[model samples]
Target: MSNSTHISTLIKERTGLDVGTQFRADLETILHDLAKGDLEQYLADLRATNENAPPWQTLMRALTISETYFFRDSAPFQLLRQPILPNIILERRHHKRLELNVWSAGCSTGEEAYSLAILLYELLPDLDSWTIRLKASDINNHAVQIARQGIYREWAFRHTNNGFQTRYFDPAPGGWQIKPHIQRMVSFSQNNLLNEVPRPQFDLVFCRNVLLYIANDFTKAIETLIFDSLIPGGWLIMGQSEAIRWQRERWTTHVFADATLYQKPLPHQIMTPPSRYPIASIPAMPDYELALDALYNERSSEAEQILKGILAEKPGHAPTHILLAYILGSRHALSSAHRHLDDALNSDGMLADAHYLRATLFLEEGKDVESREALRAALYCQRDHPLAALMLGNLYASIGDMAKASRTWESARQAVIGLPPETRVSVLSDMTAAGFDALVKGQLGIANK
Candidate 1:
């Protein structure tokens, strides 16, 4: 085999890393740095079957970037503080089992794992009786060692409250030392994700910012392993930039205002956890026409107020929830829109229009996984949803599934034609029939009528 191929094989064999398709240039840089001037000698040494390979950890460390700080990105931590931890508390409360197990796969220097422990401490009450296993691991032993020390410089506290430093850490010589209670919550280890078996039934797993470093194939492998490791209804969080968009079958893209979390769906569960405030009495639900008329006439303020009144009264009314979500979505009130959508689905999981509207919201936000679930849910509820079919076709095209897109658009075309001439569909905005006509012609290669 060529030296480069052999080196790649060695990387995978020794480090469980695939280096990925964009590695050649990076490999050259690494080789140049390793050689300093003697490329030939370096290649020879790398290829040698001496069974005495130089400590691969140095190369692993050189290739991987480990820059991290407490609550880096902060969104997932915010999510933990809200619905995620609280719901877990509720689920286990009745059983008198307050058990929370968490893992940070690419712990780096333990910022993320500690941050999770802090969130648990801050958000939940009576945690003193809970069983908590917060484990953190990095491939780099040096990083693990530093993390075990539980000391941090000021830079790590940039995004964190100084109160956390005061409350959870004690001032020490080199830097502030993590308080014993906080430090005791976490166990630090050096782990190769591919080689190590993840502890199962974890309440949540933070595998963020780690998958992108591995090869595309290995990333998939790691994702599957994570999927298997999570208990039903457990949460998996990735880096904000990562794509859970394509992982619909394995995870529910639980889109929040600040973060998108992947949830291992509970078996036989339909929607997310039920709304805390379910309506007690059935109020007279209003027709969507008033809101639609106001919205279509550019009277969004009038429409929003009407929706607010209706929802405030009959929060249990699924159709009203869907319409409000639709109106709020058009106005780009995404956080509120998602809230209404979640409630609508919870009230009635088979609401096709609500699902379609949700799909469009995710699409506008550039979230594929989030969009995919809603689209699929829309189709699942009512397969002939023309707009959803069209958007699903668009989504298929986006992921380079042209053949599927072609077939899907063909179906979407028929669905569109089957609609009454006056039947209107709204995406980011209301799309005219003529617009849908041209959409298929341009996207599906249909000849002009």
Candidate 2:
């Protein structure tokens, strides 16, 4: 029962978004950084402005970390390719209309929405005959604009293995531009998830890796909205880390491999957890563990060999890909590392460790912006991420934003304090809550109370 502050209420009123305790540091950082410590004056200016959108949107933009690559998480895509798409297609076949409506809520730059379209094209033999609509929305207008453009850098294709780049993208002056048909498939709009999602009753909805940043009440409200947006039997997939505690009576939890899914069950459908998938698709037990051991001990080559061996057996084993990325990163094989990171996330976007590793890699390479995004993604995936908040706070310090940095450090301290003794986060950084507090107090001139 956390009470919302005035600033939090303002944000909630404007966008139906909550700046919860978890995001307090983030909000404070943005406000303090923008205002240069005179937050009250900034607030007054914001209040006086007729164009309320700018101030609010600026804060929102800073708060959002758009750290997405195309097909960064592949489990849901697998479900789509295997059964979801086929089932949806079959369900609508009786009407003689191959109609599909899909929504990618919080779609950063249209990669996910386009990925769905590509899957649809690949699966259906007669795609042209079908009435297809892939609608994508983001609260960030800049991201929405970028999504509409359909042009992206090489980095965006890191997780992409389907040769979609070869078939669907043309080399542009700056980067790769998606072709007309793929572009035509997805429609991007700037919309906040909390308030309005115009198109309802989607066959499949993707709101992956997006909800955990919001407050609990808003998250439930958003979930309710998603439930309402679905066709009776439509499936809703979230990020790997996000496990919905929705009332079992309304939805059936479907476990597929390491992925858990919720399907909007139709009338008279049982509300029990779906049985374990009978397919022998899970990675062989010892190899992944062995690979992890090799990775932690600095056996880069050995780890790569082990991971590659496992990958040959189970190409979709995302953890292997992530480990391989870490190994390659140590070797300064940055491009290769990006591919592995993308593939790992593509395989399972819920891997907070992978995002943490990506942040570490980015920091090593002196890519602070990329590291920030990676850290944010890691926190979003797993709030109790190891050293993520600390590193991000250090990153702000490096950028000379002491106010933001100090606030972030405080947040990290609070997070650590709340952790159970047994489940405490461990990182090689060897930094503790006491150490962080001392550093922040000394550097940022905070008074000891």
Candidate 3:
């Protein structure tokens, strides 16, 4: 096997992480950087020790994503605030028990864990009479240490805008410190999900955005671990981009207005097909969809032809104009793209997509200031425009305004977190909510580094 293959196999065997083709180059680069001048010796040494060794820890840190914020995604938290926790509380209250056990699996740096504690604190009026075991754990020991500190900079509070910082945290040296009362609600520890040890009976388990990094072969095992760890009729929440598709029948799926949740069924409970979002009655422009599909499939010429035909029939069609502008931009025809975008804006002055497309064109022409202004216009039209926020954050980062950049990227993330992963965003192209989120995550990761 090649060195890359050997390293991939080693990583999988040790960490249950698949360094797939998308990240194989990154793995090789890490290997070269760590190996220095002697690759053979480094590989042999890595194979000689257990995964918990310093070398393995360094590798895991490089591979795993530790970028997270409090209330990272609003949708899941809303679901928890609603039927999930309330239902659990009702069940417990019937038995005269006011205890809650919530686990934050792969809880990097404790933001999510603390968010859970805060939620429980807010929801429970008779908090003094309740036993809340909000356990949080991660495979990275370094992250666990940071979590134990309970101090965070401004970047960690990007998602918290409802005066949570003032209510639950106090100003401390280096950053804000989570209040002692909230800190005492959670216990942080280092844990690997692949471990087969006995797990706690958690009322709710949040393993969001963690399984995306795991090998395909190992995701089922980890899912099973989570399933076994939850009590019957308990809830499991995943990230917007993640889901329990395989072996989904084992858990009862609940489709909420904002997010989808899974529950472990009680004994003899009937299993029903997962409910889907109701399709809107309004029909979309079929030709516009055809053009979008053609563009997405890389048949640009065909898409352009279809878009032109649509414009010939309906000159005021802003969506077709936007799609044509996208095609022109992709082909490096900036002037043509701008003309089409102008037409789009003329048809509908409040079109956020047109403004965002204008920003992209400005950025490609090296007009950073113009691009920034265009992005601001887009955001003004629609405050939660993900792509506009993403581009604006990039511009901020490029100019050394990292604090502003983090806030902007967090806004981008928040905008898309409530939507279904497959929900289409950007009329300019075929970007999905999941795709936009990945871009935001990449930006945040670079900022964190």
RMSD of each: 14.6, 18.8, 20.5
Model 3, runs deviating above 4 Å: 196-200, 274-449
Instruction: Name the 10 consecutive residues with the lowest summed lDDT in model 3.
Output: 275-284
What would the per-residue lDDT of candidate 2 be over residues 1-449, giving only the tens digit for each residue? 22225556656655555564557666666667867787777676666653236766676676676778887677778666544565466546645777888999989888888888877765554568888888898888877888899899989999886655887799997888998888998988887777674445698889887886766666777788888898877788888899785565587777755577788777656554443221111122356557666766767678789889977966655656766876787788988988888887775575666787899888888888999999998766545443676777778888777777777766665555533444324422334545644554564454222
| Residues 1-449 of candidate 1: C-alpha lDDT, one tens digit per residue | 65556666766665556663547667866756766766666666765632224444566566666888898987677446433565576557656677888989889988888888877765443457778989898888778888999899999899875366897899999898998888888999887787767556787989988876676656766787788888887888999888663456656775554567877877865355421211011111123456667878889788778777766754545656767787788789998888988987764455567788898889889889889888987766555566777888888888888888887788777666634455454422476656776777688873211
Compute the lDDT of residue 448 as modeled in candidate 2: 24
lDDT of 2 at 127: 67
Worst 10 residues of 2 by lDDT: 275-284
Error of model 3, residue 1, in angstroms: 1.6
Best-performing candidate as measured by TM-score: 3
lDDT of 3 by residue, 1-449 (tens): 76657877887876678775548667778777877756677778789987677877776777778989999988788556533565577557768777899999999999999999988875564578889999898888889889999999999999775566888899999999999999999999887778745464889999988988888888988898999898887788998888895798888886754567888877665465543222111112457657778888889899999989977876656667877888899889999999999997874465667888899999999999999999998776656677788889999999999999999999888877757899765555467889988878999998999
lDDT of 3 at 326: 80
- What lDDT does each candidate get? 0.71, 0.70, 0.79
Q: Work out the TM-score per prediction.
A: 0.56, 0.57, 0.60
- On lDDT, who's better, 2 or 3? 3
What's the ranking of the predictions by lDDT, best on top? 3, 1, 2
Model 1 gets an lDDT of 0.71
